[model samples]
Target: YKASIPKNGGPQIPDELEDPKAFKLKMETAIQATLKSEKAKGETYSQDEKELMIWYNYHFLGRGKPTTHIQVLSSVNNEQIKKNLPPVFKEIFARISSKLKHQS
Candidate 1:
């Protein structure tokens, strides 16, 4: 199974996450290399960030369902992800949260 992040409210498969374990391993490599990759860039990941990364990898990359995505998104403690991720990602999350809230 594979999970992905959406580039335009649609699925985007990251080449690095082709192998979940490999991606996880790559995440721990030297900061310089991570900085060179657009996926990681120069930012240092906190525990929350790491968890989100793993979860997303498993969810989108590993074929986790949309309902699961909704549940996870609803449960997320967004302060950290909101602060760390790009504005577009934050907006996307907000939109998903809003849509899910309205659905319930």
Candidate 2:
């Protein structure tokens, strides 16, 4: 995903979010929140969730396709939440990217 983002000229993380664990935790929390909110509003899972579920089923479940709506709507609120991160959080992301490039 990071690789693809650069190809499109998207904003890069600075130096703060470089740790894989921190990145994963942040992403997970955001996705879970998105899923919960969508479920509450009865909007069904979003496009990103569909893509992720498809990948999970193919790789983890060894299936040709997703078999259940539950799996499709599992959890993507984390990503949605990320879309609305506060300014401080954005700075952290920028810092993470800068650190990756050794741009002290």
Candidate 3:
């Protein structure tokens, strides 16, 4: 899995996760937990895909945000890894998209 520093202040997972799949799962769980906890704290839940996309952009790209097309391309560079990433990212994206589809 590709590794990069997130732009926002938050906890960072360690780099020695060994298995990328497991690491991705952990990240997904952490994101959901953070969002859910935020919502529980009386934050208005914004169900906008664009906003989630931007969150992911900030977390991954760490620079001026890129378009969805560019982000997708960059996230999946190797053909083999690309095929695998869609399924993994899709699940995470689905959860995020469901929460933030309006921003799309």
User: What's each prediction's clash count?
Assistant: 7, 22, 5
The TM-score measured for candidate 1 stands at 0.27
Error of 1 at 66 (Å): 3.0
Which stretches of candidate 1 lie above 4 Å from their native place?
A: 1-44, 64-67, 70-104
For candidate 1, lDDT tens digit of each residue in 40-75?
A: 643567755654554454455445568666755666
Q: What's the TM-score of every candidate structure?
A: 0.27, 0.24, 0.22
**Model 3, span 1-104: residue lDDT tens:** 12433365434443434676764544455445445443332235444442343355344444444554465566656775646675779788788989897777
Q: Which regions in candidate 2 have their CA more than 4 angstroms from the true location?
A: 1-76
> For candidate 1, which ten residues in a row score worst on lDDT?
1-10
lDDT of 2 by residue, 5-24 (tens): 22544322233346767544
Top candidate, metric TM-score: 1
Model 1 residue pairs with clashes: 2-61, 2-62, 3-60, 3-61, 3-62, 4-60, 4-61
Task: Quote the positional error of residue 44 for candidate 3 in Å.
Answer: 10
User: Which residues of candidate 3, in runs, are more than 4 Å off?
Assistant: 5-57, 60-64, 67-72, 88-104
In the order shown, the candidates' Cα RMSDs to the true structure are: 13.0, 19.0, 13.7
